[model samples]
Target: MPGLQTQSIHAGRSIDPSTGAVVPPLHTSTTFERDPDGEFSRRYAYIRAATPNRDSLEACITALEGGDETISFGSGMAASFGVFQALAPKDHVLLHRDVYYGVRELMEGFFAKWGLNHTLVDMRDIDEVRRASRPETKLFWVETPTNPLIEVVDIRAVAEAARAACALLVCENTFATPVLQRPFELGADIVVHSLTKYLGGHSDAMGGSVTLKNKPELVAQIRDFQHTGGAILSPFDCWLILRGVETLVPRVRLHCENARLIAEFLSTHKGVSKVRYPGLVNDPGHAVAKTQMKDFGGMLSFEIRGGRAEAFAFTAALKTIARATSLGGTHSLIEHRASIEGKTTRAPESLLRLSVGLEDANDLIHDLDQALGSII
Candidate 1:
């Protein structure tokens, strides 16, 4: 097997046979021409069903995740919804309580309307996972280094419980990219990613993927959903994501490095009441994170000494860091979780999630210092 760095650049890549172009050509044609015998000559039949760009992107992501195959979707939420839509009407899904807010909305609104039931549990607690399992539980959904809070769940422990319950285990690997964690190696059956984040790196492309480890049955089902649903990624976006992934290894390394420095700086700041970052030795998730992840990842959150008003003020005072909703971009972003999540928020009123980016460590520290000083 090639090293991750090598695979990131070379996997699923080839020179153009006719043009001798080093980069893969973008295939934007929605439909392909048929042969004289009424059969398609190319590997692709139509854009929605298949395309060179989408195929190349899928192959790269599949290799990165150490999975057998992958299915691409228009957005991360669409990819997640595809899985939920595949389940039987009454099938149960066990999800991490601190998942991305969009997932919460999907389950509570759309999936609920479809008659699928869900149980939200602290996935880091294997005992709680075991206790929550029901005979009808068909899927175990996990999001490690969970959104906003960065709670690192033990993937191996959760996979064990999922196996015992005869359920399919799926790990959302958006935060801890394949560079840091490979859930399939830890015994997960499926790995999901919001390619709009780390894999895209630039936040210029919007995409999602579901990679299957040795499970042919689920793969076929999800593949069918992607094909017939028509929510697949565009060829241009696929090409952009492919470009982003080529530099994934180096970019993620810098993201982790910058985040570690930022986390440490925030921990000692007088205005920060508590910091929730797996990189911090005292963090509740640190021990488990160290065991399963190669790096603690780039996302983290902290609570202000005061409440929502103080958190908002601190964000407003920041000069270098931007106040934004999304993560995994070159620019740093800060968000007030309570305000965004509203009534269903599990985050603290004083909590702010920081998507630490590829910025100078000293500059990031100075910006945070100024922001905190203003609020304090």
Candidate 2:
């Protein structure tokens, strides 16, 4: 197998046979021409069913994730919904307590109406996972280094429990990315990613994907949903995501480096109450993260000394970081997770999530220092 950096650049990419172009051309045509015998000459029939760009993106992602099959969706939420759509009615799902709020809303709203069941558990506890398993439990959905809180789940342990319960284990590998973690090697059946984040790198393209290992039936269902359900990403978006995948290696390495520096600085700062980053030896998830992940990711969260007021004040004073909702962009973003999540949010009032970017570590530290100083 090629090194990850080499795969990132060369996987699913080939010299254009027709135009002799090195870069894959964006296939903007929604419909393809048929042969004289009334047979389709190419693998693609319609943009809704398939496209060259979407195929290229899916192939690249499958290679990166080390999965046998892959599917692309219009957005991260759409990709998540595709998993539920693949399951039968009344099938149960196990979710991490601090999963991205959108997944929670999906289950509580639409999935509930459709008779889908869910149990939210602390994924760090394998015992809790075992206790929560029901005969009908068809899926174990885990988000390690969970959104906002940065709590890392032991993927191998959770996979063991999921396997024992005869359930499909799916790891949302968005935060860790394939560069940091490969869930399949840890025994997960599926890997999900919000390509809008780190995979797209620029945060300009919006897309989602599922990479499957040893699950042909589930792959078919997801492919059906993608084909007939009408949430397929556009060719232009697919092309953009492929372009972003080219530089994923160096980008994530720097992201991890900068975040480590930022987290270390925040941990000892007087204005900070606590820092949640797996890179820190003292972090609750540090040991497990070290076991499963090649590098601690670029995201971390910390609690301000005061409550929501201080959290908001700190973000308001930042000169370099932007107050934003999304992550994995080139620019750093800070969000008060509790405010965004509202009443059901488990995040502390003082907690702030930071999406560390490809910025100078010292400059980011200085900006954070000034912001915290203003709050004091």
Candidate 3:
């Protein structure tokens, strides 16, 4: 129970009440009975409001993160949008420049004019982050070992930045998971996750969850927003995610090992111009990564020797590894980063991202070796 492996085994799950099943059953009921006085909103009154299945999933996440409250959403973007909506109109936010493409696009495009001002800065530079601060800034969104690039920004350092600016720091712990890194202890006010990826671990479910640090009112507001605004995950998806949680700890450990090996291999490969992973000793953020993260996680990116053509060739040459995006799944995945982000400058061309799954290390090495050999 002390370690992640043990915690994952028993956290946020149980047998059916009606039947003695070990795994929690999917409660598809839209409403639950209440007193006739209308004194209660009733359990599972509305699909959008709340459900036993959703609460069970939230409780598990809450225990795992040591957060007071957690909210589940239909998608990662919906959870993120809810976070923004909870903030004030005059709030200016400082965020990492290399965040997820969808969030970056949303912040720059729609939310910018929606009275929520944002400043995207290279978070590694403490001075730059300090300089970009605005008095009205309220949220500091960050992602370490960021999507595709694997840039490791110092959470504690940025947390200091947020504290000085009077902004609440929120870290996207999807890649590392609570198993690898606890943002709450690192001075983050909130933590976000795309359960569709690592939390689900199979990429079978699309869901998101957010955890608040000791903020009951904030938790209540997000819960209200989830209930009223209606982005709650389906009972089935929540149940699937609940299942994924049972193996998260063990899966993440293996993912980290596989990723580290691949990063080292890619670093020495002549076909790769650059490999971005905090686990590498030569990486600029390696020290900070070691300090903050329990492991460097399963995601790493390498720039192909040539531009888009070489990257495409290399990806197309993969055999066992799937040529696709999304991280922390059981099957290894390779993504041509530029293709998904369109015009966003966050993801670079010639860079290929890898999500090291539960596959054997040697097989993955062979796959990469063959792909690189064929790229020329």
How many clashes show up per model? 0, 0, 0
What Cα-based lDDT does every candidate model obtain? 0.92, 0.93, 0.87
State the lDDT of candidate 1 residue by residue for 1-376, as single tens digits: 9999888888888998989999889888999888888888777778888999998899999999999999999999989987888899889999999988889889999999889999999998888999999999999999988998889888999999999999999999999999999999999998999999999999789999999988888888989999988879999999999999999999999999999999999999889999999999999999999999999888999999999899989999999999998899888989998899989989999999999899898999999999899988
Report the lDDT tens digits of candidate 3 across residue range 275-370: 989899999879999999988899888899989988888888899999877777899999887888887656668988899989999999999999
Q: By lDDT, highest first, what's the ranking?
A: 2, 1, 3
- Tell me which of candidates 1 and 3 scores higher on TM-score: 1
Question: Candidate 3's error at 10, in angstroms?
Answer: 2.2
Candidate 1 vs candidate 2, lDDT winner: 2
**TM-score (C-alpha) between model 2 and the true structure:** 0.99
Question: lDDT per residue, candidate 2, 277-357, as tens digits?
Answer: 999999999999999999999999999999999899899999999999899989999999998998889899999999999
Could you estimate the TM-score for every candidate?
0.98, 0.99, 0.96
How close to the true structure is residue 351 of candidate 2, measured as C-alpha lDDT?
96
Candidate 3, superposed: residue stretches over 4 Å from native: 39-42
Better of 1 and 3 by lDDT: 1
